[model samples]
Target: MSDRNGNPQDPDNGPESPHRLIEARLQKMAELGESVELYPYGFDRSHTSEQMRADEKSLTEAETKVRYPGRIMAKRGTGKTLFVPVQDERGTVQAYFRKDDLGDEAFHRVQKLMDIGDWVGVEGKLFRTRTGELSIHVEDFTFLSKAIRPLPEKYHDMSLENRCRRRYLDLAMNQESRERFRRRSEIIAEIRAFFAEEEFLEVETPVLQSLYGGATARPFKTHHNALDMTLYLRIADELYLKRLIVGGLEKVYEIAKDFRNEGMDRTHNPEFTMLECYAAYWDYHDMMDLMERLMRRLARGISADGKLKYGEVELDFSQPFGRIRFMDALQDKTGRDLMAADDEEVAAVAREHGITLKKGMGRDKILDELFSELVEPGLVQPTFVMDHPKELSPLAKAHRETEGLVERFEMFVAGFELSNSFSELNDPREQRERFVAQKALLEAGDEEAQQLDEDFLQAMEQGMPPTGGMGIGIDRLVMLLVDSNNIRDVLLFPHMRPEQS
Candidate 1:
């Protein structure tokens, strides 16, 4: 007779079970408050359970008898016998149970209570089922945890809205979501390795600053009681990282959590991860080369090829990234050179394009608005739009060839800006002037203008080496690499409005 409790058969008080048919027999459990408890307290970790179930075909003869513990993903067939698909984190395997083997009472238990999604451990011999599926034939079994709620039916309708809202359910059922995350991990690993090989010292910067002066973006402010002052969450790590360069760290990088008080869209997030790096003695040109190589490495690992197919666009990372001048791109699209265009002419062009160029809107802001509305959406390939007007790029050094433009380049892929690099300004005087100009702009109602970071200026006074700094939106890059159009798909948990209480 089969021992349900794995104990000697009793006659008089033999299994004081309910009078009703034992349609389902729970296996002897090692968990606390469970049947014939063998463990001391919590039994979350199954001691005898195999670390990872090996494929039967790949396993040695001795390994074929391995017992595995996992959740039941699916169940089919019943009556005198049952077939259940058990899934551990690594993979899934089928488990078979029979009425004759489990005996009368045990067989009934299997029928009623052995529901899908319950965690169970089975000590079984590996063999091929008559259906040609590799399966485990139970010698003995144990209950791990009983899942109270039933999982969604595998054949149930799955909608995009439902998938995003109930991500846990989607994760349990959708293989695509699982694989995307797996690739995300690999991509991060490859990026870290690449940075390490380049001798870039990864450093952490302050998240909450007394004065937020990094990038030109609105800041989320909060109060600190002990200090009795308002603190602003960092929008970028540029200012702080550059300060480190002044303090003698030649090459430094920060994989920072930057918070932007901005609109949430398909490509924008309020809080995001960015890989910002600064290298001494490197210019924007050199930075672009490094960036291309890093991107190629990431694409190679993500797809195991130098190309990634993203939304009808096959982006080939192997080929040399194309370079285009910002003004030339403008001239190409607008039939007028930016340098030759007066304020009136620029405003006329803006009006023609239905772009609202406000009163006292400087040439730079007009150009920026025009670029966003017209030029940006057109850049679908891996193209670098270089030599931005000086007013548009505050931190970048003045261009060598142009009179009023900066040596900066923004790389776009699949119509999204992936990376922004610049020949960083090393002149303290010029840098301070730029900050003063920005402060004036801020005072004149341009809240998104860069702030005057006195500490950063002081660092510049101490002499920072000529540097090339770059910031890459990791989420955007991941989206491109994974061929995901929606930014939320790349992010594990995106910000959502609180539900009504």
Candidate 2:
């Protein structure tokens, strides 16, 4: 077989020959007793490479003994001494392996057994190299695990499709990918801490449901053979979490994995993380405050002055985010008052703006299409677009002052919707009416319409609090904080198409 460039495709004969390397590693393993037990489950790593570097001066003076386990990143200086770079999760440290220091048997073992990408634990004394680089001078070493396949030469610069498909290699070879995931964890931890500090109870909601109702998105469906019933992977956790609120768990939040049978894009994924929080007795206005504080806290956790760069723009999270009424923003951008316009007028405007209108799209859908095309791109700075039309928000409460708008807001930054908040509609009758309207749209070929879940309405009838609810796209939030352009850059294992044979 040949590659696209007409190069030989056989792994055993190709450059950096993965098949040949794997065979050699297997042989080496056989020589060293070769079972799963050869690779021990745990190693006592006294300090991380990062910690050793931080305490370099003190440790070097004290001649402190340390045990560190890491993947061998690079090896140099073959004969008398070996200078190897070993990387753990935190950072990388250079290891100096001298024949005189390790004596003959151990030095020969290190040379014969170790390879780049192999996992090893080294017992060493902390010191600094002549060039002032923090290093560990090894006294002895233990082989932990072996890597059979060769890593890509320029893995960091590999194509995005390959990076997403082989994320383990991407994480191993690219430091940026490793650090981005690290920051993702830290960001989520800070978010949980912020909610906990605010007296919110962290809760879990079911990922599989008998009926899906919460967001307007197509759901991934499955069947349970035992129950002999069809089920849908949750498109959102809003309905279930609100049920918890009805069951008297006030101020509840869930960080959940939401699945949508949707198209993939820079921002959209089939499976994604969502942070949904509902606070009792609060309104959309209060949600706005909470969203701002949460974003600011995340910025402060990752940056110094509550400011961070997303692509070319420097987002300032310290100051209050800007706000624009949804209809006003639409009017300002497209020079059309969509709220006041009839369906035909809105359709005309959409056509004039070169926005493609799907079949059976209503006035609200047309207006939203226009807003996404014209208004959303200009909202680079943190801005809240509030008071959406009633048709655009089925679950949100009707606006207190506006005639035909709902108390709903979507936070946008860098041309992407980061968070959505609603003054939840607790009236069972009103919610039922909204669901009926949604059912009409669904029957009219809109697959992304919310389904009427009777149980949820029963819960509402039993009485749900006047709640303020918010759903933040956690992946997008991580992207903004980490300056990642693609959502997959932040997601550890984003969905990808199957490889063609």
Candidate 3:
């Protein structure tokens, strides 16, 4: 979030100056040391602002005493009394403090040094003000903590960069930021609940791997000091989860952090969360069905009616998701069957479409490019872009009906690839052949090509069953549910460029 309102200010400040404001607060803290502990160890409290608000009716009727601790967000009036809004995590409560209630020294101490953003514990009886608003008539108060610098004046007006960078300020000042992240947590929980209902066991996988070979993405490389061998941060959890399926864990899912050494954008992040699952005896069709059901569950969990408006587009989860074959969609867009075309023909289509082909860029990659460039953007509604070419999905089983295609489908929503699934290839010999093809691509200078993992091949050779695997970009899913525009908005602390000193 950008600080569009310029800099925050202190109560007595004229124009903004950070050094002056901080130094002034520091001096005040030193003075307050004589009357109270500026950095006190703790403040005993009976209720949060939310709890206080909830019990207000009974408490006010009984004239009950309550202790509440929270950060001061707003301060009003002067002279012998003041009304301040003390905010805790859930909400805020109005606190009324007067010289008559606390006597001369305590009230004088508060008036002299207490500032907005300071945390205080107050003992008070609940009552309504002249305007009939619920308020705490303070009997006593204690200083808990002090904020040396003022908070941003207009937090919502902050730029995206600033809000993400200074998430602490954003959470403190803006209710929307707090609620958005809380919604992210709820969405994740709902996903887990949906899988649990389907009896998929939640599992853990390694973050670092001996060899990475799930998705077509470069990995963040690292060295193991003890073993003294090169290890790569996992780019996806597909391989390990598949191994679990081979070991007879028929249904499994992992919500994992994956590192991909790639470009960063609104949809892409170097480090992101992924939900990868594999099921034995299941095919891509079963996985697609599961995705649709899960989407409906997640939509209702985040919003009522299972419907949402993201920017100008309204996404309705109440209806069935649309379906289109990968090749069919591409052919419709370009008025030609580029899928049946030869390697050179595909390359020509790519160039004609203004997609830059790298050194090892093959026909499958070119086809994917064409789809992404031409057909993907129009997938505003939920859709399954199904039956991709065999070369494009090295780990997917060959399609039962189609000659050159694999049983693969990509779920696209709001023009973004939400998930990818495949009827996983189980024949060890065919798997080896696919690995060889990928190896050839790797040798031809494709940094994003999947490497042949001998151990993974060995597992497949050990009579692995026909399995279905799917991976959901959890961050992207959260973005759609929460209506977040950037991937960074969902991530607590997304990867960023180092500050230039």
The models' CA-based lDDT, in order, is 0.79, 0.87, 0.87
Query: What would the TM-score be for candidate 1 when compared with the true structure?
Result: 0.87
Which segments of candidate 2 are over 4 A away from where they belong?
A: 1-18, 34-37, 154-156
Candidate 2: tens digits of C-alpha lDDT, residues 1-501: 123233444454444544666777767667665423457888998999888877877887888899999988887876989888888987888889999998877776667667788888888898878887678899878788877666677424877776888898788778888988989998899999999998999999888899997998999999999999999999999999898888888899999899999899989889999999999999999999999999998898878799898888999998999999999998997787677788888899889999888877777777788889999989999999999988888999999998889999999998899999999999999999999999988898889998888999999999998999999999999889999898889988888765433
Can you give the TM-score per candidate against the true fold? 0.87, 0.93, 0.93
In angstroms, the error of model 3 at 485 is 0.8
Locate the minimum summed-lDDT window of 10 residues in model 2.
Answer: 1-10
- Specify the poorest-scoring 10-residue window by lDDT in model 1: 19-28
Candidate 2 residue 189 C-alpha distance from true site, Å: 0.8
lDDT of 1 by residue, 82-169 (tens): 8878776546778788878888765554455666767777766777788887677766776676654556678865665556666776
Give candidate 3's error at residue 361 in angstroms: 2.9
Misplaced by over 4 Å in model 3 are 1-18, 344-359
